[model samples]
Target: MDYRIPRGTYDILPENSGKWQYVKDVFRRVAESFGYFEITTPVFEMAELFERSSGENSDVVQKEMYRFMDQKGRSFALRPEGTAPVVRAYVENHMDKSGSRNKLYYMGPMFRYDRPQAGRYRQFYQYGIEFIGSNHPYYDAEVIAIEMAYLKALGLQNVRLEINSVGCASCAKEYDLALQDYYRQFLPELCPDCQKRYETKPRRLLDCKVKTCQVFRTDAPSQLDYLDEDCREHFTQVRAYLDASGIKYLVNPAIVRGLDYYTNTAFELIVDALGAQKSIAGGGRYNALISQIGGKDTPAIGFAGGFERLLLALEKESIPLPGITLPKVYCIAIGDEAQMSMLPILSKLRQSGIYADYNPDKTSFKAQMKAADSSRAEFAIILGEDELKQGDFILKNLMTSEQERLSAEDLLQRLTQ
Candidate 1:
């Protein structure tokens, strides 16, 4: 029987693993540079966590989340996003009581039941940052700076930053009323989903992709215009901090986070070359999320970026990424006895932190040399009957074709140096 990998997921083969690792390392370095420590959570959590944090009406919970019941009939779900689980851990572990701010980052796979497309997947990797215990607008800009610095480190040039404010609950309540008043006239022409969203989440109507629903969005109530005094001041401070940090951005009122928890500052990084899935990364403040999910009413902000889209953007811009590593040395032995002798030296070389490779199956000297060259090794250590008898090996520099006879101890010293 022939089996296939489930749709919407792809393997990170050896050829592509190096690139993944390189980007992950770059994100870690940038996050740490901003005083963010790493935090990891379970791949799956109690289903209610998301329903509460992301909102029951959010697309992720309603149409995309992978929900299941365990053998005990207890409902569970693979996390669709990273923020809620990190907040759950923080609250459960009492990180809030530590009397200091929590700047944390995480990287891992997120599961969703959405349609798979270019730069979109059922199982995709995400890197995110969460700044807890502060509503200070500086934390918002600082979190954004980490993502900007990471993209710069990866040499992505065509990405643009778009920022917005969703305002607080009171402001949202007023804005929702304005949205309803404006859309009530066109209710008959709205999509069924938007019709329901009219009463449930008016902000979601602005994000609808249907052409019919999109026509009304151009004149929809802008969230920025509805921002109250505190929210307006917060947005201004965030923009000021970004300016002081020398990060460029645009104020886009159309930016609404897909989740219900986001408030005040919302932003996304866009790459126009990516077409419909142009947003490479995005996040916003969730001041009420911790309290909504059973923690002290601590304020926090964060962002998450998908590695797949980020890599695709890098590709579109022709940015170079690390590839498969080649061995430093490849061993070739002409005979069985020589092959046996080469084994210990190969082990020694690897033990001394050298990337050494060998293939005992190839017995012909010519075939072994050809394999060594194909391996792209810097040096080829050749073991033949004559060299074995003389207690020495011939080290050939594959690039320079320079040959030198050296004792096994001497070869180790030379390679180590």
Candidate 2:
């Protein structure tokens, strides 16, 4: 029987996983530096949580969700996005009672049944944060700053920050009505998806990437024009904070993000290096989400970027990520007696914070040295019957081809230094 990796999933082999680790480390450092803590939820959750939080019309809920009924007749879904699951956890755990803002971040794999493409997958990794319990616009700016700072730290190039206000509930309602009236005339011209969105989610019509849809959406109503005074001011303050921090950005009117819960201050970090799916990171304020998912009214916002896409962007831009380091020492044991002696020294070297490895097989001397070289060790310690009796070993500097006789304690000291 021939088996293959599932359609939209890919493995992170040892050679490539280092870049992923580097990105995660950089993100974790930036997030913690800004006082954000980490939060992790299960890969699967009750399907209702996502359905309710993402809304019926959003693409995540309507399509791409990996929904299934378990043996107990309970429906569950692999998380297609990060924010909804995080919000569900916050509500179920009663995190709102803490009376302080919850600045939590996460990095993990998210499952979505997306059409597998160059930078997308069925099971892809995302790094994200959720800023909960704060209605302050500065929090919006801070969240944006965190994402921007993270990308900059990665040394990514030609990236752009596009900001927009999808408006508060009140103004968005008016904008929806306006969109309905305007698009109602051109419904015949829109794609079937946009045609449905005209009734279900009018804002998404402007976000459509269809060629035919774009033709009719040229003069589509801007959400900025309909922003209420409070919403307008909130967006202005977010931009001000970005400017003050010297984080360059553009105010894009067409950026109605792909979720129903978003309100005021939507932004995406775009990189042209990765073709049409240019969004490296994106998120915004969702003040009504807490209450919508059965919690007390709490304001929140956050952003997430796909790791597969992130690594792709970095590669396309020719940015260097931290590489995996080689073991500091490889111990070569020539005979059975030497092998037994080498084992304890290997453990001791590691215990003392030196990365060390050894070949356990009964191999020839030439084969053992070849193994040591293959292990990429900076130095090789050769233990033979003679050296085992002499109370010292031959330490060869793999890089310089220099050799010196050293006791076990001396070898550990030299390598650790």
Per-prediction TM-score, please? 0.98, 0.96
TM-score, cand. 1 = 0.98
lDDT of 2 by residue, 1-417 (tens): 999999999888888777878889999999999999999999999999888988875678888899999999999999988888898888888787766448899989999988988888899999998999888888988999998889889888788999999988898899999999899888888899888888887888887889889887779888899988999888888888788888889989988866666899888989887888989889899988888989888889899988888888888888877677789898898888888888888888898888888777737889989999888899999988889899898999999999999998898788777
- Candidate 1 lDDT by residue in tens digits, 256-352: 8766668899999999999989999999999989999999898999999999999999988888888999999999988888988999999999998
Off by over 4 Å in 2: 99-101
Show the lowest summed lDDT stretch of 10 residues, model 1: 93-102
**Each model's C-alpha lDDT?**
0.93, 0.87
* Model 1 lDDT, full chain set: 0.93
Residue 318 lDDT (model 2) = 82
